[model samples]
Target: MPEIINISDAEDPRVAPYRDVRERDLVGREGLFIAEGEVVLRGLLDSSGHRPLSLLIAEKRIGGLADLLERVPADVPVYAAGQAVMDAIAGFPMHRGILGLGARAPGVAAADLLAGLPARALVMVLVGIANHDNVGGLFRNAAAFGVDAVLLDTTSCDPLYRKAIRVSVGAALQVPFARLGAGEDALDVLEAAGFTSFALTPSGTLALAQVRRPARTAVLFGAEGPGLPAEIMARCAGVRIQMSAGFDSLNVATSSGIVLHHLAEAIA
Candidate 1:
């Protein structure tokens, strides 16, 4: 069993990092992110790419985590408190009662991530997607469809944000991702790496049923309203999801799921 240091005061310095989590959140904590709930915590524990720094768990729920705690490093701190105290620290209801502080190497360059992919690969590229919920949902879909990695343009939001991690059920940690710098040509990078790129949009010239899955594919999606930039779409093969005549629009996440599922079926 991991050592459980009982914390009664919400102001305790040891648990300070977890305070005001929802409103203020732990910012600039040197790449550390809060993994909440049993599912997210389990993902943190299972992931080798990211490491849990410590844990802040509700005292009443400690028994439920015995098997999980065994996998945690012995040196990491496990701070336990009552539900009320946990609620006070989080500045929220604290219903989930489980949280882990974890870290991963931050700011992986898109080129470095692309260079490491296998010859036959599937990548989901995001351009100008700033919403945390959408970012999380994309990662979830990417993982579900066996995407090799997700590449985000400089305008995209960080998937490590607390809300995003929670919303993704921790897939942001499970699915590998790297962010591109400003002016970086992600399609050119993928093309040079031998990937045929597809731009998904409602106005796409090619029908979804006409797509020929490539050995290595990179599917690009943009933020909902603006969608993919015309120049970028023009550079890649454009494919559209067939939808009801009146409803050409779909949530970005929903559209990604539909497209990825179709592509996944053609995987060799």
Candidate 2:
């Protein structure tokens, strides 16, 4: 077990990194990745590319964290504090009772990712997605649906943002993502990789069940309001989910789940 430093004061400089977590997203430019709950923490630890920098646990919850503490390197700091102090330091109620700070995996080049991609790969390309939760949910869905990789467009939000990482349930750490340089948009990059681009849109020309599966299928999606850029949509095969009326569109993440699930099943 790692040495458990008892924290009595919220102002302790040693724990300052955990303060005002809500605002940390704005004040911190380099971005911070957080893994909450025992399940997510274990998942992050299992990943080869991610490592925890430190951990904070409510005094009452320390017992449940024994397995995690045992797995993490002894050098990693594991601190214990009362509920009040934990709440004050985190700037909110710490329901999970345990949180881990992990290093963000460095961004990779899109070309490099695709070059090594396997046959029958399913890739998710998110474009102009601004919402952190949606991005996180999309990552979760991508993981669930067996998407081999994720590619982010120039306008997408940072997937490693603290909130995003928390919502992804550590799936963000598990998924391999790379960004394209220059004008190589998500659709263009997929095309270059011999992947057939499938855009998820309400006004899409083909329904989800109608499209033929390609050996490599890269699904492109965007945020709710604007949907995918018109130019980007022009480059891919347009497809829509079969949905009921009264609902204009699903949240980008929800739409992604449906598309990825069906596509993954098709591929399988």
lDDT of 1 by residue, 59-140 (tens): 9999988998898899889999999999999889999999898888566777788788888889999999999999989988
Residues 18-75, candidate 2: write the lDDT tens digits: 8877787876546456677787888778877777888889999888778778998878
The total of clashing pairs for model 1 equals 0
Give the Cα RMSD of candidate 1.
Answer: 1.4
The 0-to-1 C-alpha lDDT of every candidate, in the order given, reads 0.88, 0.83
Output the TM-score of candidate 1: 0.96
Q: Candidate 1: where are CA atoms >4 Å away? A: 25-29
Best by lDDT: 1
TM-score of 2: 0.93
